[model samples]
Structure formats: structure tokens, C-alpha cells
Target: EAAKVRLADGQGREIACDGVLLTGQFTPESSLGRQSHLQLDSGSDGPKIDQYGRCSDPAYFAAGNLLRPIETAGWSYREGRRIGSLMALALCNQLPAPHDALTLKYAAPIKLGVPGRLVRGELAGLQHIQLRVSRAVSGTLRVRAQGLDLWSRPVSALPERRLLIPLKELQLPEHLDQLDICID
Candidate 1:
């Protein structure tokens, strides 16, 4: 609804405004997944899915909506298509075994990360690391590996909003394999 908002006082005149913004709390419906013994994402209140949407229970697979309730229809469709294709490949034993895949854990302020995990061998093509901030903050977000700074960026984060860290140019040293993102 785009309309003038009435002033708080008992006045007839409406306040001039471009538009009205309305919002409500959005709960990620993941209790069923959790009840079924799936790993719940600490950051998103959703299932912790792998790069291919596989849940902890090998018999189960979740993509798109079941993974992230706030996703758009187009994104959900893409996830389904991509994960379905990958599942088909796995059924035929065409997919290669993951080599030294590790989870992307975080410290305080960062609740969760998309791709919850990544293959160490896949770092060369790493593109994005998305997370939900615990609260609004204005500071430098840093990714540290083995207590050494690996990457950093200025961030203005809002709760529940996707905070993306682009990693297209990341160059990891051979000795340091694990990384953690924290607000500094």
C-alpha cells in the first residue's frame, strides 16, 4: 500500500511520504527437518545443506525453500534443477568423491554461512561466502586463517539480511587451510 501515513497527533493532515514500508517477522520453518534428525543451520534456522543440497541423513535431500525460507521462486527453481541434476549424476556414480571437504565455521556475530562447507581443493574457484549477521553492525569483517588475516572488507550488516563476501580474488597460502569470518 502506497499512501500517506497519518501523523501521530490527532490531526487531519497526513504526513507526506513516498511509500509505506511494511514488514513482519519471518520464521524459517525448519522444525520438521530438525525433528527428522537433520542438521539445523545455526545461522539461518534451516537445514544445513552441503554444496549439493545433501542433508546429514543420506536418504534425505533438501534444496531451495527447505534450505532457505526467504529465497525467491527463481532461486528455488534453480536449486531444485541443479541439485536434481547432481543427484542424478551421483546415482550413476559419475560424481567424484569429495577430497578433504571442510565445514566453514564462524566466530561470534556470524550465525551461519551458505555452502556451510567447501572442499579445500575447490578454493581456486571460490566465489562467494554468504552469512547472516547476528545484529546490525558497522565495522570491518575479516576472514582469518590460522590466526592470520586472509581477507577483509568493510561491512554494514543488518540482521537476517544476506551479508556477502566476494572471494573471487582470494589467494590462500598452502599452509593455512581453514578460515573463519569475524567482525573486527
Candidate 2:
């Protein structure tokens, strides 16, 4: 006898409904980046980027949620802006020429680091080597180059978060042959 629709049942009582609102969590749309074959972060659902937001492909760049599932709008905007500026520098030949890039691989539970590739002469700053773990761990975080131990430290890894690696303290060679990061 009523025109209103019932929303749901509560203890055998019907509740009135004004309208149905579809709500759900959002996810990052990284299909284009993935389709382009850019290196993806092991712990995240988006492309990996260097400090300047350059992807494995020097010609490509990513920032914000495109490089990770979640990030603040301000952070993303600043990142993109910085990357754009860097790109302009590169294009204008103001920055150093592109150098040989090294790739970092990880083992179980250790997700991929951002800027998966390290270009020669490029810096690995105190906060540049960010990592994410799938679960909690207590182990050695080892970084090696050319099969020689460069840096290692004990860490308490956590899930769904970023963990920074301090590479500047290692005093890596200006031109690296092979560089890697792992946990054991």
C-alpha cells in the first residue's frame, strides 16, 4: 500500500530507503603504464619511478598514485612538477647525459624498490631507496654491487608501507656495474 521501497531487514522489520548509493573503495588505474611495459613496483600496483619520477624508460615519467596505489594530492602534484622540471633540464642538455642503468631485484616478502634501475652517476639518496614488504620481518637488508657487499643493515620490515634505504652512506662507485638489494 506504500510507494516507498524497503532498504533492508532489521530484526524482521523493514527499513525505508530514499535511494541506493553504490559505494566502494577506489583502485589505481595503472593499465596504461603496465601496458607500456614500464617496470612495476613489486609491492605496489603501479610503475616504479626515480626521484624525478622517471620510469625505466627515460622518455616516460610517472608520479602520484600512478607510481603507487595511494598518495596525497599535494605530494603527487609536487612530484609531477619536479619530474617535469627535470625532464626539461634533460631535454635542454643541462643535466648529465643518460648513463648505464642497474636493476634491483628482491626476494620473497620484499617488494620492488622505486626507480628499479639505477643510472650511473645518479645518486641513491638517504631516502631514495624506498621499499615495501608484504609482511613483518626481522632480517638483514643487504645492498651489493658487482658481487661485492656495499651495504647491509638490520631492519624491522612491516606490511603495506614504505621503508627507506640509506644508500648515500655506502659511498657507491660513480659508475656501477651491478647493483642490487635483498633481504635475508
Candidate 3:
């Protein structure tokens, strides 16, 4: 016969609540990507892709919440439309295959970074790189390649919200195996 529940915080604070409802633990469903043998991004637990959304197989492309997870409907819709157009171009042989691409490397508390790979020549249309953090953080987010600072900005982010890094001013080196995204 419990009328209420008491929750204790790490800082020694306690709160009484009628109930606790926990949510937002959604993970992208990637069984199909697995069965299809597409390269998987451990960060998003989805198919790894380039800025244009081309997956490991040149014939396969993925987009939207399927690549991330549980974004707003509007975001998913826009992403679908954008990637759909790219798919059409690919079908017509107008889209260039991913080359000169750099793999993205990030550590906690960065939960994920969209466009798991970045293509140098094909980056013109990509406006921003979306990111999600595993927890709350406030610091300067930086992107580095070939020991050079490609981009940096101060950010305050929470787990439930998506963060965007604009690519308009970003520049990467011609010869780099990976790009590092970090917060410091």
C-alpha cells in the first residue's frame, strides 16, 4: 500500500512522486540493414552512410529516423524527401559514388553523428551534420582532420535534443583517413 514514491538524487536530494514514467529509449530498428549486409554505424545502430545517404552498397540508400531514431515527424519527412531525390539521381547515373570520404570518429558523450562518412567532393549540398549526446554537456565541440582544426563551436546540449554543426565554413584535408568529432 504505497501512496507515493521517493526518489533520491546523487547530490542528496529527495523527491516524492505519485509515479515515474521513463521514456525516450528508442533505438533504430536495423535488423534489415544487418540482413542486407550493409555497413552498420555503431553510434546510431543503423546503416552507415555518406552525406548523400548512400549506404555501403552503392544501390542502397537510407535516411531519416531510420538512420538515427525518433526525430520529429517533420524532420523525418524532410530527410526522406532529400534522400529520395538523391536516390533518383543515382538511378539515373547522375549521382557520383562516394569517394574521397572520411570516416567519423567520436567518443562519449556523443551518442551519434549523422552522415557517418563525409565525402569531400559531394559535400556541397550538405548543410549541417546532426549529432546527439548521451548526456548533458557544455563545452566547445570541435572537428579535426589531419591534425588541423576544421570546425569548432561552443555548445550546451541535452540527450533528448539534436545538435547541428553547420558545414558552410568547414574545411577538411585532402589526405585523411578519419575525422574526429570531440567536445572539450
Find the candidate with the highest lDDT and give its number.
Answer: 3
Give the TM-scores of the predictions, in the order they appear: 0.69, 0.69, 0.84
Across residues 1-184, which tens digit of lDDT does each residue of candidate 1 receive? 2455556785555556777667655546677996877778776767875565566654566676676557667866876887788677667755444444456677768766766655444413224676777678888888777787778889888876777777554566666546778887
Q: What is the per-residue lDDT of model 2 for residues 1-184, given as tens digits with 9 covering 90 to 100?
A: 2234444663343346655555333335688977887867755667866555577666877766777655568866876777677777767756544455566666667755665655545532213676767689889888887777788888887764667776466666767755777778
* CA lDDT scores, all candidates in order: 0.67, 0.65, 0.81
**Backbone collisions counted per model:** 0, 0, 0
Compared with the true structure, model 3 gives a TM-score of 0.84
**Which residue pairs come into collision in candidate 1?**
none
lDDT of 3 by residue, 1-184 (tens): 2234444653443356566666777878677897887898998888998888899877898887778877888988888888888888888877765776789998788999988988777435446788999999999999988667889999999995888888767777777879889887
Q: Candidate 1 at residue 8, lDDT?
A: 72
Deviation of model 3 at 94, angstroms: 2.2
Q: Write down the worst ten-residue block by lDDT for model 2.
A: 118-127
Query: Which portions of model 1 miss their true places by more than 4 Å?
Result: 1-23, 96-99, 121-127, 167-178
Ranked candidates, highest lDDT first: 3, 1, 2
The regions of model 2 sitting more than 4 angstroms off are 1-28, 37-45, 72-78, 122-127
Give me the overall lDDT of model 1: 0.67
